[model samples]
Target chain A: MNEQLSMRQIVFMYLFISLSPVLRQIPTALADESGRSGYLSPFWSVFLILPLASIIILLIKSFPSLNLYEIMVHLIGKVFAKLIITLYLVWIIVFLTAKMNIYSLTLQFTLMPKTRSDFFMQIMLILVFYALLRGSKTIFRFSEFSLGPILLLIGILFACAITRLRTDYLLPVSTINLPSTIKASTSVIAVGGNMIIALFFADKLGISLTKKQVKKFWFGAIFFIIFSFVITVFTFGITGAGLTARLPFPFYITVKSISFFNIFERFEVIVTLICILSDFITICISFIILMKLIQWLFGLEQVWFCFLPLAIIVYYFSYFLSSTQFEFNFLYRYIIVNMNLLFQYIIPFLLGLICLLKRKYIKKQY
Target chain B: MIYIFGGLLLISFIKQKDVILNKKRNLVLFLLLSVCGIALGTVHMISPYIPSIAYSLEGILRTLLVNR
Candidate 1:
């Protein structure tokens, strides 16, 4: 009903959705083994840089009132617009579903082995659905309310883990070759690619984002990247890269390793909660976009009608995926690499360029 | 647990017959979308179990991107 979101809410939504605690652990855990052939070591740094660059570019190319969707439609004709959007929607759904599956799988593996995957997934879907049903404003409100606690939890984990951090892990960081480093930057792009969601919200939030807010978003993103970098560096440093590379969810493994004079142990629970909440926010943002795309494309009135089917599809997908770790690896390495690069990066970039050229041509005629 | 919760949510709405029928067309449309959502979810979950499905989709996508 309402097209615009508040400035403060936009900030909250961006922070909440961007952090994506759950999948954060996966890159480090999965990177080394999943053909990091082209990627560099101390992988986090390269990952951080790519997103930093992407966000900077996006901010500079600010559009007046159009979100990414409208801009794409305006730039391209209706047919191309539909094609691009359909491709984007599929990617968004797959990405969201993979995340949900990962969250459900992690919970099963770590916290509640006795529970069925279907059970955990359904609960997650309900929570996300509730958030989705409330619409973007409520979702942003939830983010605003939850942001502090989530940040605090992350802060505590970082603080407690610091004493265990070895600075030597960062040393010789510059040694990674340029080609490999550039290749590794793709991982960062993949992770940080979520920032593209900003285009969706820009118009809705009516964000004439101050230099300060833009700076804040980048600052937060950089901080997350650095935090993840430090955690991964020390984790590999302490555990040895060989051992660290073998374990999935290396961050969780690192959290599990934390101890305070025998007074504190098994801090993984806190870490898991952080991961779940972050992923939930990510899924919520994806769902919002999906709903909006459906409404805009079909000229539909009510958005809530769109939620149930989407939720059901996500739920079933989460349950039926990878019974073993090998399948998971295959999906990531072969399946996601191609699918994500095409839909997330190439098509959008091409569409954006075509739209820009078309606008220029139309203007000249006028 | 999810079924319980989702079912309850659905039931609460169903009880308000006027609300459900008032937007009957939208409700039908939503239900159809729900089926698609369920299919997508099912495909994702089963993709792992049936390696061929993953391979086929990936293969199709790869070809599309490459050809383009």
Candidate 2:
């Protein structure tokens, strides 16, 4: 089995991971900020996602066969790279905890409303631990195989919901809302920032990418924008922007109204199951990255020694991070989004700037 | 629940005893993380009613950003 991950697989993994945020956060965040024009925010995010995607590709192209940490070391030197890695460490831990909190909260809101969050966390950790034991490639392969069906299901729901779309809810977009749409697009941009995960796996990509591989990167970015657009459109179209803003999970509600020829009802269960699967993959990827960061930070040979303890920490912090949905919502809206922008976009932009400046020296070293 | 957590930690410590004894850095890293996890878990277990750290941070951030 070739454990070396292809660029296409990385794109698949990213799309898989971005599903939860696309489902849970983007629609409501956009609706709250942009009103009826919120659905346009996904399109607005194209300005940032394209550049972020290009920067990721450039970083991989410039520092071929190097992981993010190593690329940082080459571009900015070791001390600053370690400092940046430490910042990533903090960001990832909080991000992981937040994901866990949302996973349990989503379940509580949708299915098994009575179950303690601790039970969900415990079960999720066990599954994540098992996945980690299978190695990183397996996780990527799982996403590669699963993304197709998930997208197909979402497509079917969209087809079913097309008739139910209220044109009044989405139409009459005055010029005034464009600015707010751009602002609200930050939610989409924040979610799309998960593209930087490519750098984490760059070392496994081997040296040099073909044109086809490059196309996959752009394909992933384009797919993200389209996916976000369609999901938001469906939510706004079916559920209406006002209701979407008020509801926590508007896509779930939007799906509830869809039935195949009035025969297959309660498609919301499929939505719930997809969200759960996305959350599981998201958590698994976060753990892999978290352990990788720890290994890089401490110069440790084997990260397995730290995995159990880290899982325990995440288990407890999941509870400590946000005890209720309201707190989680607040944190997500303000702190997490901004933090993601910093780590995912700004830092990578700066790194890319430095990489261009030091290109000559880097070539000499390699 | 706390006892169960402790039991799992103990089982982990036992299973990794070879690396714990041989590798100094791994041992230190392992111990530090385990201690932090145990302490946080115990704190949450002991005072389940206390407001979460996020709630506190949210209050502070909201005050600073919104109120001001």
Candidate 3:
């Protein structure tokens, strides 16, 4: 508990947690739905990149201390601050519940169909509960510990997949219409919006990011963008856009298509493990944020009080959606799009503007 | 199955009483809350009640503020 994460560990945590396993199936899901909608083209996909850049820039400017909540309080009045913070906390809880449901449902459908949904959720909740109990420093340490092996595995998988790549699949990329292309960019942005969790840890993470650290973080973000783009391109190229858009786990299918000496036949398991690990990390981060936000909002001396309520909320809500398809469709079509804009983009931008205005007013008074 | 795990976790809490009362209290509370959660989960399984409530509230708010 006394251990603090070094800057390297913090950077690694951010990188690994941002490009999480939950994202592996995301491209497939998005491409499947959005591609048909003619929104998978690169032209519009770039819009998706802006909000992440905007959020990161906002964090970098406000850095060293002051989380989104603390910053809101400083910029806005206490009443508005409390109101906004409460809404954000509810959003986080709902978002986390949705994610938990998705992951659990995905696992139930694909890997362990026989397992009861409640059982899967309970196990996940226990893991998240344990992770949250250990606190953020421990979570960061775990990230540091797991980052190396995970990266190495991912590297190997990527290397293997590259050998089987077909460049021809990437052809006719320019054929996508302008409107469709633009919408695809928003999908990419929505995917990248996962990085906003960085804000939850930004305050405790210590703000003094050196030029090197900033460069490294940006490098990681660039790496993630390129990685995603490559995976999409390759999957599309190999499977064809139409087929790629239809596969639920297209990247996994891409991995499945790879055979090195026919010995490495089942690489989908590796993808599954990676996805589960990433999901675990994300859920842990979400749980920690929930606990911290609750404590902050309620002015509670103990953070643990928030955990029970959170666990209960997550547990029950996980079962609320009748099926995996419902969870996936609801999340992608409605929840993520709206939540990403409102909470991730609009709220933060508004708060940052309010801070700027407040500063100017104070300066004028002086 | 959830109840069994919950029971075991509860037992672990009982065994760890010497660690810290504060920690024990939290474990007990979490276990109790999870019990309530299981009940809620069962209720949800039976009815699409919660989302309907959320939707209605959202609809009302949207209607009062602006056209949805």
Judged by TM-score, which candidate is best?
Answer: 2
Better of 1 and 3 by DockQ: 1
Model 2 chain A worst lDDT run, 10 consecutive residues: A1-10
Q: B-chain TM-score, every candidate? A: 0.43, 0.78, 0.42
Per residue, candidate 3 scores C-alpha lDDT tens digits across A315-335 of 776555334554455455456
For every model in order, the fraction of real contacts preserved is 0.43, 0.79, 0.21
Candidates' TM-scores?
Answer: 0.78, 0.98, 0.80
Model 2, span A273-364: residue lDDT tens: 99999999999999999999999998877777688889989998878888898889988998799999999999999998898888898788
Indicate whether candidate 1 or candidate 2 has the larger DockQ. 2
Misplaced by over 4 Å in model 2 are B65-67
Q: Please rank every candidate by DockQ, starting with the best.
A: 2, 1, 3
Q: Say which docking band candidate 2 falls in.
A: medium
Every candidate's DockQ is: 0.31, 0.77, 0.21
RMSD of 1: 5.2
Candidate 3: pairs in clash? A44-A181, A44-A182, A44-A185, A45-A184, A45-A185, A48-A185, A48-A189, A64-A207, A169-A237
